[model samples]
Target chain A: MDKRKDAGSWNRHKIQAVWALLTNSYLIGFAQGRIYKGSLKNLCLPGLSCYSCPGAVGSCPIGAMQAVIGSWNFKFPFYVAGFLLFAGALMGRFVCGYLCPFGLFQDLLHKIPFPKKIKTFPADALLRKLKYVILAVFVVLLPMVVVDILGQGAPYFCKLICPAGTLEGGLPLVLLNESMRSAIGWLYVWKNALLLLTIVASVLIYRPFCKYICPLGAVYSAFNSVAVFRYQLDQEACIGCGACAASCEMQVDLIKHINSPECIRCGACKRACPVGAIHFRQAGKSRQSNTTGL
Target chain B: MKRQLQSSKAGILLALAGLLMAGVGMHRGEMSTVFEKAVKICMECIGIG
Candidate 1:
């Protein structure tokens, strides 16, 4: 392993590590088994953390969108929509690589030595599109179409499908609060089952949730090709070594699809490049940064 | 530089649009609405009911 490549991975991992703590640092809320009621709850984190999580000071954007869209008024989730566009424009799926607690969860699970590490398969590309379906149906259409007597909609994604809510928020709350435990029913049981599936799948595959299920990642991926900061391939300096593609778990064809929506901007290719060909170009910066090879 | 400008154009427009929409949401008191809902006053928001 090249020390330079190792350092880059380390820096990213370090940010992921600190981010996990900072995002869920409302310690007293966890001890008491109560959700944080602070004003910070109004802001949406780029990650898919559960607002119901006792320690979550900020709301998850997906949940926030559903909440607003599902409200009786059925207004557009302007705030949440804005935030997603804002985040997408700035970083694309870089958030998936470095910021999301759920992404961190899956990354850790994938590291737990398994019989096989499945990067992708025949149905991988098709399966990857599932997140967009989930975003369209569970997050958007279902909430709007399926309404109650009062015209309010349910947070369908959170209640029915979100392992983030189940794992981060539901599990901890149920464990600590006796009252919540007593009230646990079929919905809780169903969510826990989904959470269990996600955990098991993570061990066998890499970032399975990000690849297939996370609606937030789906949103960010839309902007990946044109995000303000993105990877660039210098055709002039290229040797076509294929190392970058070989190293990429996402299997992105580095030259043809340098900034494809599927690319998570994980820098795995950048690390794998033996030649000084790949670099990150910021929107307004005169020079591309970190153009040197490992 | 021309290529760079072309690429950055979409992103800059998107950022500005996001800011404008967020401003509208703020003016409409939607942030407070998010707060109220995140507080989880009703069980149905989380599907317990």
Candidate 2:
């Protein structure tokens, strides 16, 4: 009945689901506005679903929030904010692990048969601060402050750096639409090239963007401590083998705190624990006695 | 069997939500002539108008 024995099946199912969601061209087409009025609309999803995707049925909360706050007549977007908070509270970074189409894309790119693996440098404390700075400046304050002053606001992250927007929204549509191809300028080519480079780098690096960047990850991480469906470490059972930390791609020191914000609950640590020292339960689940495993 | 049933129910609920949203988006014009309002809502939601 140990969950670790069946961990392979769980990981496989999660990976398969990710592929299904990402490669569903019909869904992509719907999001891109091809099936609709040929205008970009918002989806109410918590993650960054590109409004430009033809198959997207709801608005991306991140994009929607930016558009609302950047508007000349500023009014609070209660629906979008409420939806994001609700989703974040319920699932935490489980959304990052399983639901995000963009995250799925990054995972696939990381699966390429590369000779080397990029390990995290935990000693480099400055590198860890980058995502928080990005979240505070680019994701939150900049959009509200700079865009309001300029009288025109853009999805700054998407326009400048987000390889996700290029991969999920731009490249596919441009290939399909002839007019779009003609309208493509130097900027479009530059963005596409950046996306291509990231894809190639991901093979060598384990989620470079998620580790060092990704404002959304920064936000979701803050809630990981209290999120429902959290990981619990049986301290007495832990032999301090460090196997969990060794296997962790997210670079979490699970023995210290399995529910650390950096821990994506990817269950790598749970599976890696030789002594079955780790288990997952809902946040409010009664704490059980911690018994050491032989 | 019970676990399988619960998973199936969860899957169904997610699928239904996705379908309902897609349907509503498709008939957006019929639902509301609130393009400007929707844009405004989206702008505030995203912090870029």
Candidate 3:
């Protein structure tokens, strides 16, 4: 553990921890079976904090959307969809960059003392499209098409795929309640296996789930180019050097696709740029912000 | 820059329309239903269902 870097050194990580803590403030019920039946539960947080977590005081937008779609009435999820669209249009994958609790979880795990860090592989570009596929199939189409005799469809992604649901909600609840352990079945076993694999993979790879799996990230990425909060490459100052791309873990070519959908707006490229060529810019503003130092 | 400017305006307008729809949904009591579900343990979400 001595070989590990000091977590306190990274200001971004500290900010991320603060955000995660602020969003999950119902710590009094952290180990409890009863969920907080508060008015705050009606609102959706901008990140992937599982609704089933005892400390969770708000609905996960994705889970909320799935629930709405899976209801017996099969009503349209206007609020959830609109919330996602509005958030995407406003901040793009900045939500993932700055707010997502699951993103922070993977980030901290990757910081653990590994002998060698893995670089972005060639297949990553192709595999990143999988999240969009998941969004289309599991999140949207499956719920819309497949319904039980009672006209209620299952929340397929949450039930089958989401490792966050397994880790944050399942593991904690099952561990705390003796009664829940007996009820666990093969599906629980399968989810645990998936969660374990994802945990191990996070240590080896940078944001493996966010890069290839999270449907929310896929949805937000669609708005990357048009989102109000954005980054600009001052072509005039840029010398076409590859320094920015060299430091970017997301495999984004900073000089080429300055606002690439794959980019989380993590500001790594901006920090790496030698000539201060990259900076933050809002959509309507004529002048860029002094966020290059960030 | 012109194209980006136009897209920005479009994005803002779309967000406003989304906000309106979300408001309508809230008025229709979707918020209460969402809260009702959120307060539950959601066994299916944890793969126990």
Which candidate has the top score in DockQ?
Answer: 3
Ranking by lDDT: 1, 3, 2
Model 2 segments more than 4 A misplaced: A1-43, A75-77, A121-125, A148-152, A286-294, B1-49
lDDT, each prediction: 0.82, 0.58, 0.81
Model 2 Cα lDDT, one tens digit per residue, A26-55: 464544435223233433555655655555
**Which residue window of length 10 is worst by lDDT in model 2 chain B?**
B40-49
Interface DockQ of each model: 0.60, 0.06, 0.70
For residue A135, give model 1's deviation from the true position in Å: 0.4
Clashing pairs in 1: none
Off by over 4 Å in 3: A1-9, A286-294
Docking class of 3: medium
Best-to-worst ranking by TM-score: 1, 3, 2
lDDT of 1 by residue, B11-49 (tens): 888978888888888777778878887876234333355
- Displacement of residue A140 (Cα, Å) in model 3 is 1.3
lDDT of 2 at A58: 50
lDDT of model 3 at position A125: 81
Question: What's the lDDT for residue B37 in model 1?
Answer: 79
Of the two candidates 1 and 3, the one with more favorable lDDT, higher being better, is 1
